[model samples]
Target chain A: MEQILANGVYLGAQYAMIALGLTLIFALMNVLNFAHGQMYVLGGFVTYTFYGQLGFPFVAGLVMSCVTLFILGALIERFLFAPVIRRSSRDESTMLLAAGLAFFFDAVILLLFGEKQRGVPKIVNGVFNWDFRLIMPYDRILICVLAILSIVSFILFMQYSKTGRALRALAQDRTAAQLMGVNVDRYSMIGFALGAMLAGLVGGLLVTITGVNLGMGGPTSIKAFMMVMIGGAGVISGAIAGGIILGFLEAIGLAVLSQYGDITYLMIFVSLMIFLAIRPQGLMGKPWG
Target chain B: MKRRVVLKSAVAAVALSAFAAGGAWAENPVLKIGFVGVTSGPAAAWGISNQRSMETRAAWINETGGYTIGDTTYDIEIVSFDDQKDPKRAIAGMEKMAQEGIHYVVGPNVDDGAAAVRPVAEANGIMYFPYAFPKELYTAPASNAVLGMVANYQSGPAIYKYLMENKGVKTVAFIAANESDPLSQRDGGVAAAKELGLEVVSDNVTYQVDTTDFTPVLTPVLRTRPDLLVLSGVSPANAPQLIRSARELGYQGLISTETAQDAQVLQEGAGDLANGFISVGGASTPELASDAMREFVKRYTDMFGEYNDESNTKVYALEYILETLKANPAAIDDVNAFQATMDGFEAPNPYMVGDAKLRYVGSTSFGQKRQVAVPLVVNVYQDGAFETLFVAEVD
Candidate 1:
């Protein structure tokens, strides 16, 4: 039980970080950024090249990932999404654009990174075996701590900062924010860039543990989407809650359902469907607070 | 005027002959071979090795005066498709090959892709060598899908028997990814372990292919404490993670897999933790690799920036296809003729140190000559490379 809890906490921390970024983008733009996972993968590759290949400090690599993704997000919003959202009548237009970007990123990742699975040297070594009850690697524990710290920082920023306040105002009511003299166009781009930065931060932190691959992009996006849906489509707290819940479910299901084998994932999916059927709006879909 | 007319007539005759010669040169035939497999995505290494091997060999053949089959010399051209590991896409890849008029091809590397292309291959008179091990694929009803490399069923028993006799392996556990190819391999490995009188401690554990954390997945399997742990049909991407997880969980037993693996992937993913892992690999062991094999590796490394050791086994599929075609040229456009030729086809294995013969043999498992008889070279991972352990063969 202790081991399962530890495992769940670790998984939940990282998963929540991933969900936070996706939900943030959706909240700001109503775009449901399908390319969020690819952004995460690109962030991982950036770190891999910087730290693993070029022998830079790991922290430097992570900061580079965040900066690179932030700029990319800003440009994409400024040049692509912003114009499309203005010209189009339906939100599905944004969805189509997001989907197209996902494919475009997939091709770019393949062309640039090739198809080989890549991994970095362990940041920390040795296992923390607690009386044979809880066996977690030191590296995993460090990553979990880092992930939690990032999430906490994000929450604090969203609560206190002026930019965060403006972004929140925009997310709350775009027309009202525009009427109140907020630069709607600029904050929308910043919001998207900030969301992308968070994805990169988490991607950098987790790359040491799970490694990165081109194929991981689509599945990562799918998993992130599930977390958003569980939390409530455009709710930040809901996304975090959804991520943690899904993480624990996986840890527990894998631990308990060892006897039943392949049906573990099947059971998890079935439960998700049941929950969705019961509460169509999800756990935190009602409001931002 | 008479002198001018004669000179013009002679010049016209020379120009017409030059044109005729140029037309003859342009008419030289190109024999097209096809490869349909996953060349991108996580499992890309598997199919990439297969495609690169075919391309490398084709280029070698074409550069050195081309290949001759039944007195007609033809340049070999490899046409490839990236099925992206999808069954429907693999079917489409095969149809594309048929449309291109390629009669012989290599790959569709995994079981699902291999099985999916069988009907298309048969209908189009295309003979394909797939690196999959479904007995039904090689049985009487299916004849076009030749087993490209040693199957898990064949390699599993060979590996288990060797471990039992040499390392005193008395008990075993099996874990597999929850997919068709891996599940099939796990079942086969379990049966082989049981047949060898080894106690099967645990065999039903499976994890999703996309699983990032394998600790919880390995915890229960490690608790069983078997002497040997077989990772069934593991891909290059997952192998190192599984090894690292098992080791971290304090599994002290021998770890082995029937699938060929990339040494670089293992080294990068698990580092020193992967040291002692055993797998079936290409015949690239220093003791077994001949000068021809060394040159091929050099060429491969030159062509691609790095080399995947799995190509050791993959290089033979194209060789077998070409060799069989050479033995009976009538088989080039008639896959039925190719089937008829398989029973008696034999040639000297060019890449091995011994007087080994290249042939088709699967009578023991499929009651037909439906598998390439490459020397099954088992490899043990140490440091950053795979060293040859023992070599075996399947009938």
Candidate 2:
């Protein structure tokens, strides 16, 4: 049981990282960026090239991955999403566009990297043990700590910072904020960029844990969607709770059921249905207007 | 009237010349051989290795004016399809090959893909040389199927004996990916371990092929504290991750595997952690090479920049096919005769990997004539190189 919980906690940490970024985008944009997972994949590949292949410092690789995604995400918002945002059914159109971009990213990565799995070497090695049992790796511990710290920092910034306040104002009421002298376009682009940067940081963390492969994008995107939905769409705190729930369910299920661990997805879907039937607003989310 | 007669005669002469030219074209033809496998997915390395061997050999043969059968010689044209390691895609590739009238095929490397592809090839009367380890795919229903690689039945026992006698391994824990070949390997491995008097302390553990974190699977097995861990038929992409995870979890047991034949991948993925790991593959180093093997390694390295064990096996397959065709020319036109010839065929070249001569054998599960009894080499990774510890001869 201890082993299961330890593994579950680690899995939960990674899921929360991905879910946090995805939820932020939904909260600010009101658009489900289906390409969010592809951003994660691209970020990991960038880290792999920088730290794994080019022999750069791991911290440098992570920072560079964040910066690259920030710029790229801003450019995508400006060129692709800007013109489409004026439409009446912008949400559906943007979602479709995100899906198309996801496939396009996969194709481009496949062309460049070929379809082999690439790994980022562990920054720190060795295991921590309790007597003859309960062995946990230091790298996994580092992942959890880093993820929590990053999430908390982002939340604090959103609460206190001026730019973050502007972003939150736009998320709360875009038209009203615009009327009150908030630059709607700049805040929207920055919000998307911030979300992309978070996704990229999570990618760098995970590449060392699971290794990076091209096919990771599709499954990961689906998992992100599940996390967001289960937590209530457009709710940051809900995303965290939902991610941990799903992660623990998977890890504990695998520990007990072994080969039938995939049934956890079905269980999560059932839970989603129950949540919708009862408290559709989710644990930390307000009821939809 | 005289001018009209001359013109008619000239027209008839030109028509006669065209007919004669068409008749000459019928004497020599291009023989289309198809290769279907996972050429562009996570398992792409396996398919790419086979592709390198087939394409390199085909190029050499073409350069030398092709394979000669009696008085006529035919150029071998290789048509490749990437199945992406999926069964449905493999079947689709087979359908496409059938439409194109390709008579010979190289592989559908994975067991599930092989199962789907075999029937299609059999139904189309195309002779297929598969790289899979499954038994039933080579049976009566799929008479055209020929296994060019070693099966788990032979490898499982061979590995067990090596670990027991050579390494003095007494207890083992078995793990496999949840795929046709890996599952079959686990079944074979467990039975072999029991037969060899080695106690299996842990139950057979299985994980999905795409499983990233093996902690959930490996944690319980580590608690058993078995003397050895056997990863049977794990994909090349997953093996290193599982191995690293096991080591990191503080399981100080001897590790053995029967998959991921590429040494470069093992080294790159697991780093120094892979040292002392026992597996069933080796590079074509100088000492292990015969004259022909040396030539093959040199040519292959020149063409592709590196030589791995899969490259050698696939090359052996191409050699076997070419030699078989040269000996029995009629088999080129008649796939039934080709299948019969392959059923009883022995290695005509000095391709020494196993003990004695390499040949096809019958299986009770498949209940038909199939599978080559290739030598299973017990290789140990030490000091960044694979050293052959033992060669289990096939009887």
Candidate 3:
């Protein structure tokens, strides 16, 4: 049980980091950024380029990845999302636009990088002995700490910082906040850049554990959508709570039913269905305003 | 004077035409061969290396006055494609090759690539050679166009038999990727273990291709407390993660697999965790003392600047095909004649396993015995490098 918990915590941290970006984007733009996963994949490629190709330090590579993805996210919002949101046709238009952008980005990435998983150098090496006969890697622990820090810092930023508060107001009521002289367009772009940066950070962390491949972006995007839906769409706290719960459930479920052939996906789907039936608005979630 | 001038001009034109025809006939025919692989992914190392090795061998053949078929010598020209390890791409590549009239082609290295190209090759009457071990290729109703250089499903049983006899392994757990190819290889391993009277404790497969977090899978396998851990069809990316994770989890059990045996795989992918793992392959390490092996290695490194892999079985088989065709040019004209020549032909094991014989089993399937030998090289990772433990003929 302890072993399962240790594993679950590590896996859950990664999910939380990835989902935080999706949730943040949702709050700011009122549009689900499906292309969030492509940003994650791009983050991994940037890390690979800096560390593997340029021979930079692992941490430096990670920072470069974050910065690059932040700029890319801002650019995406400026060109792609801004035009669609300006028209304000319907919610479906936003979703369709986001989905189209996601496909386009993924296709571009595939064309450039080809379909291969590339490995990044491990940042930290060594194992941690928790108790008698229980050992885990320090990298996983670092990831958990980083996830916690990012989430806390994000919450604090939204509550205290001037720009973050403006972003939140814009998220809550775009038209009302705009009338109050909060630059709605600028905040929306900032929100996307922030979300992309967070997602990129998670990608860099994930590279320490697994390889970065072109196929990863699609799955990451799907998981992020599931996390956001489970946490209640556009709810900040809900995304975090939902991410952690889903991550833990997946990890523990995989551990328990490891003997069964090809049951992981089925188990996760069934669990999600049950959760949806039990709490329509999610565990810690309220209906979207 | 006008008639004389016209006759002279006509004679000059005829002479020019005759010279052109002579030049065309004199120049060696470029025999086009196709090579297919996933030239773009994490598994790119294997694909790249396979291409390099084939090119090296082709260069060597061309340099030696090319392949002699009867009175004609043909220059070998390889047409390579990046299949990306996608079955659709593989099929498309094979179809393109067939349309372009390539008679002999090598590769589509993995099982899925082979599966894609096999039917197309059979339908088009084009010969295809692949370097993956999947039992289904050998067991099914055979086709004439496909030839698999690696040993068949029987090799797994041979491996298990050897382990039970030598290593004293009683209980084993199988870890494999949850894909069709890996699943098939795992099934073969499981069947072999069962036949050898060994206890199979657990079989775990990961659905995700880039699974780094193996604790969910490995913890349960470790709990079973098996003496040996068998990995089936592990890709280059996942092999290191599994090894590292297992090591981190303090699994001291003997690890063995054929998939992670490539030298490049160990150096680039596995790193330190690769130490002490054992794997099987179709070729032995090149001995510097042997002129052929040394020259081949040197030329390969000179051309490509590194050892792409140590699998010389494909190269040797390819060379064997050339040699067979040379000895009997009539065989080149017909598939049956070619198979007959391949079956009858024997050469000194180019892989240098000692008295190992190469004979093509007459099967139409691409994996059919192009060459017959129990040429399995067992390599152990020692002192941060792969060293051959034993080269036994697995019957």
Candidate 4:
């Protein structure tokens, strides 16, 4: 049971990080941002190149991954998303554009890095012997701590800061916030960059544990999207709740099912169906106002 | 004017005929070797190694003025198509090679890819050399196909024998991919373990091919506290990850696998954790290899920047193939004659193990002799390097 919970916490922290990014994007821009996962992968590769390949300091690589991906996200918003979002078929064009960007990013990484699986050296190697039956790895502890800190910091910012409040107001009521002199365009860019930076940071951190592969972005996107939908598509708190729920469920399923651990997907889908049937707006999502 | 025109015409006709004759006489007979395998996806390492090794081998042969048979010398060339580890893509790649009149073919390293391309190669009467270990590939519709390495059945017993004897392994926790090749591997291990008086603590653990996190499966296996963990016929792509996960979870038991050939990749994945892991094939150290194999390994690594899995086997097989070509030059045009030459051929072993001869396992069910019985050695990664231990002949 402790082992199962350990796995759940490890997996859930990653899910929460990814889902938070997705929710932040949706909250700010009302775009699904399909390319979000690709940004995550790009960040991983960047860290792999810097720390794993170039032999830089691990913390430097981590910082560079966030800064580089944040800048990239802002540039993408400025040049690609902004132009596409203004067109008559804004939603359709933006979705198509994001998908295209995802493919482009995957192809670029494939060309640059080749198809081999790359591993980043763990920041903290080996387990810390607790003398108990349960063994705890330092990496897992670091992951949980970092995830909680990021979440709390973001929440605190949204509650207190002028920019964060404006972004929250925009998420709640775009027209009213605009009438009250909130710059929607600038907030959208900032929100996308923040979301992308979070994804990048998680990717860099998780690559040490999961390893990085060219095809990882697709799976990461699918899981994060699943979490977002389960948590209520645009709900911040819902994403966290949804991620933890899915993570624990998957861990428990794998523990019990053993070889047939693939059945976790079916379980998750069934739970999603039941949840939708019971409450259409997700666990914490507001109904269409 | 008529006399001059006739003189020019006669000169042009003679030049044309002479040019035609020269073209025919100077046309060097070429031996085309085709490799169809996964070169573009997650399992790209396997196919890439195949390509790089074969290319190096061919380049070495070509540099020596090619293989001579009768009064003809043929330039050796390798043409490869990437299948991406997909069955349909493998078949398409095989078909493409066949269309290009390539008679000699090698690889689709995975079982399904081999299964997909085997029929196409056989139908086209191509000389197929497969590294995959599925029994179905060696069974029906096998025309000029030869198993280049030890099959699952052959390696399993050898692997377990080494563990039970050399490593003093008493109990094993077995995990294999739930597929035909691996299932066969599991059977071999079980039979060998039983015969050798070894215990299987948990014999029924299997994982899907795409499973990345092995903690869930290893959690239960580690509880049994077996002396050895057997990951037979698992993809090379997954073996390192699984081994690393087991280590991360504090399972200190010895990990052994038959399908892991590339120690470099495993080391990269597991870092210091890869120590004490056992795998089949590969020279334990540079000193264990023959002079020829040492040179080949040096050249291969210097060129590609990585050590290939079973470098000795690849070089030996290529040399054997070259010798077979020398014995039957006409085999190029007639694949049956080529098959017969390979079937009847014998040579001294060119690997680290002495007294082991290059031979074949003639299957009565397959109705023809295919599959070369190369020397099977058990290797362990100790102190961040591979150390070769026991050497056994493939029966």
DockQ of 2: 0.30
lDDT at B98, model 3: 85
Worst 10 residues of 2 chain B by lDDT: B347-356
What would the TM-scores of all predictions be? 0.93, 0.85, 0.78, 0.82
- The candidate, 1 or 2, that scores higher on DockQ is 1
Model 2, first chain, TM-score of: 0.94
Chain B TM, every candidate? 0.92, 0.86, 0.84, 0.84
Give lDDT tens digits, candidate 2, residues A99-200.
Answer: 899878877877676556677678888888877456777888898889888888888998899998998898788899999999999988998999899889
Q: TM-score: which candidate is best?
A: 1
Give lDDT tens digits, candidate 3, residues A204-239: 767767657665676788888888778887788888
Per-residue lDDT of model 4, residues A1-289, tens digit only: 7877887887777788889888888877778888887888888888888998899997788898899888988898888888777774566777788889988887787667755677767788768655535666787778778877777788898889998899899899888999999998898888888889988998888777666767667667878888987788888899998888878877787778765524556777898889888987788887782
Residues B22-64, candidate 2, lDDT per residue (tens digit)? 7854555777778899876457768877877888787777767
Q: What tens-digit string does per-residue lDDT give for candidate 3 at B190-256?
A: 8778878999998765545546577677877777878888887776556767877787787888787
How would you encode candidate 1's per-residue C-alpha lDDT over A36-114 as one tens digit per residue?
9899999998998898889999999999999999999999999999999999979899999999998898889876776
* lDDT by candidate, in order shown: 0.88, 0.77, 0.72, 0.75
Question: DockQ, per-model, please?
Answer: 0.57, 0.30, 0.27, 0.28
Q: Whole-model lDDT, candidate 3?
A: 0.72
Q: In model 3, what is the error at residue B69, expressed in angstroms?
A: 5.4
Candidate 2, residue A254: lDDT: 76
Clashing residue pairs in candidate 2, if any? Answer: B354-B375
Error of 3 at B198 (Å): 3.1
